[model samples]
Target: MNMQVWASLFGVVLGGLLSYLAQFTTVRVAGRNEERRQAAQRAEARRAERLELLREFVTIAQEGIRVAEERDQAPDWAAAGTPEWFAAGRSVIDRLWVAERMIQILFPPRLYRLARTYASAVDHVLWRLPDQIAAEGSMWHHLRDPQHEFLEAARTELGAHP
Candidate 1:
């Protein structure tokens, strides 16, 4: 080939190679960005699931507290232990047990420990005699401190607070 033709051929090949490389690089970078975005979305979804689980646990535990208080108020609760009272109390405890197990499985060690502490406080209220509960006043009073600690830990873990 003549010098002009050879030069033209070289330039065409060089330009084509560079264009192919640029397109390949762009596709690779785009693929990586897409992967990162998908990972972030999955992490956020897991966080949302954790939040829902914690909320459910708190609700069940609070119900337990309410049932305990109601039992304390009943005149025949401690003495006769009516079938209705036992049934209500048993229902709360059963649900609380399930929630506690879930917390144990899904939460980190610190949160699980705090949750157990709070559950213990609830148990104290439930098992206490009427006179003992009366001595302390409201059932909420018994649960307030432990519940506060548990919620604080949960909020911190959930990144709800800075």
Candidate 2:
């Protein structure tokens, strides 16, 4: 072949290779973005589930308050310390633990510490009984602080507001 013809053929092959590489790079970048989008969605679903579980505890707390206030009978401290209430409370607390674990496993320790704090509080309240009933308001006050701190920490860690 002539020199000019050979050079033209080499140019075309180089252009074709460059075009293929550009398209492949675009595809790879798009895939990574999609994966991140899906991960965000999964995290959202997990958060929703965790919040639902927390709502269950709130509902039980409301009922438990009513149970504590009955005029006919004293509060059921016996049941509170029993396996039953512990199981119910554990159900809610365990779900929160799992959800936090799923998020980073180890990065944020706030949730774990918060759960432990409340669990201990509940245990303390459980022991103090109808005596603590007068202090139930105080116990609940302490409970609220931990919950608020945990949520604020979670928002900071997750870059999302509760």
Candidate 3:
């Protein structure tokens, strides 16, 4: 081949290789950036989901406390000792248990256990109280301290009065 023709072919081949390398590097960098962006988006979505679950858990807890308050306030003749009253009271306890279970589904066991102590206490009271109180009268005083502590803990943990 002529020297000029050989030099021309070398230049074309070298230019093609350089162009291919540039394109490859550009694609790799773009792919990495896109992957990082997608990872960040997924993390944000998971955080939002966690917050929603916490809100639901807090709401359920508040409802239980409210039912307890209502039950405590009812008059002896105003449906205090009836089966419906117990059912209403029991429902509040039931809801708390459900919330605890839901939390287990939504979060790690360690976090759920943090709230479980209070939940278990409330649950025990609800289940074991009816027969005990029926014989011994309402142990209303027993509820006061635990309720206060639970409310405080809940507020501190959830950043709300729930």
Candidate 4:
């Protein structure tokens, strides 16, 4: 071939190879960036879900505590059949049931166990409170430490505090 024709052919081939390499590199980098962005979005979504569950669980627990406290303040002789007593008891039980379900759904095994234990403690307290109040004349002595333990575990699991 003539010198100019050979040079022209070489230039064309070199240009095509460079263009292909540039396109390949761009596509690979863009794919990796997109993958990273998607992963980050998924992580954020999970964190938000966990936080929302924690908020709901805490609210239910607090409501249960309030009901229990109210029952404790009632007169010791208040019969269980009374409307006030029945309503308070029902409210506490329902709240605890919902909280337990939330824990089972949202918590890891360790945290779930902690929450269950706390629920059991609350249940025991509610069941025995009336008799204890009548006998002891007060509701000052109850095993409520499990509630704090559960709260601490939940907070830690949700990455809310330290």
Q: Which candidate, 1 or 3, would have the higher lDDT against the true structure? A: 1
Instruction: Report the lDDT tens digits of candidate 3 across residue range 1-162.
Output: 699998999999999999999999999999999999999999879777767766666676666655655555556534654777678777777777777777777666666775576676555445444456467455345455555564565455544544
> Model 2: which residue pairs collide?
none
Top lDDT: which candidate number?
Answer: 1
Number of residue pairs clashing in candidate 2, backbone atoms closer than 3 angstroms, sequence gap of 3 or more or interchain:
0
The superposed Cα distance between candidate 3 and the true structure at residue 143, in angstroms, equals: 7.9
Best-matching candidate per TM-score:
1
Better of 2 and 4 by lDDT: 4
Residue 138: error of model 2 in Å?
A: 8.3
- Checking candidate 3 for backbone clashes, the offending pairs are none
Candidates' RMSD to native: 2.2, 5.6, 5.0, 3.1
- In candidate 4, which residue ranges exceed 4 Å CA deviation? 1-3, 76-81, 84-88, 133-143, 160-162
Steric clash pairs (candidate 1): none
Cα lDDT of all candidates, in order? 0.85, 0.56, 0.66, 0.72
State in Å the error of residue 28, model 1. 1.5
Q: TM-score ranking from best to worst?
A: 1, 4, 3, 2
The candidate with the higher lDDT, 1 or 2, is 1
Writing each residue's lDDT as its tens digit, candidate 1 over 1-162 gives: 699998999999999999999999999999999999999999999898889989898998988887786777777765646777678778888888788778888889999998998988887787787678668888778788889999999999999897
lDDT-wise, the better of 2 and 3 is 3
C-alpha TM-scores of all predictions: 0.85, 0.53, 0.68, 0.77
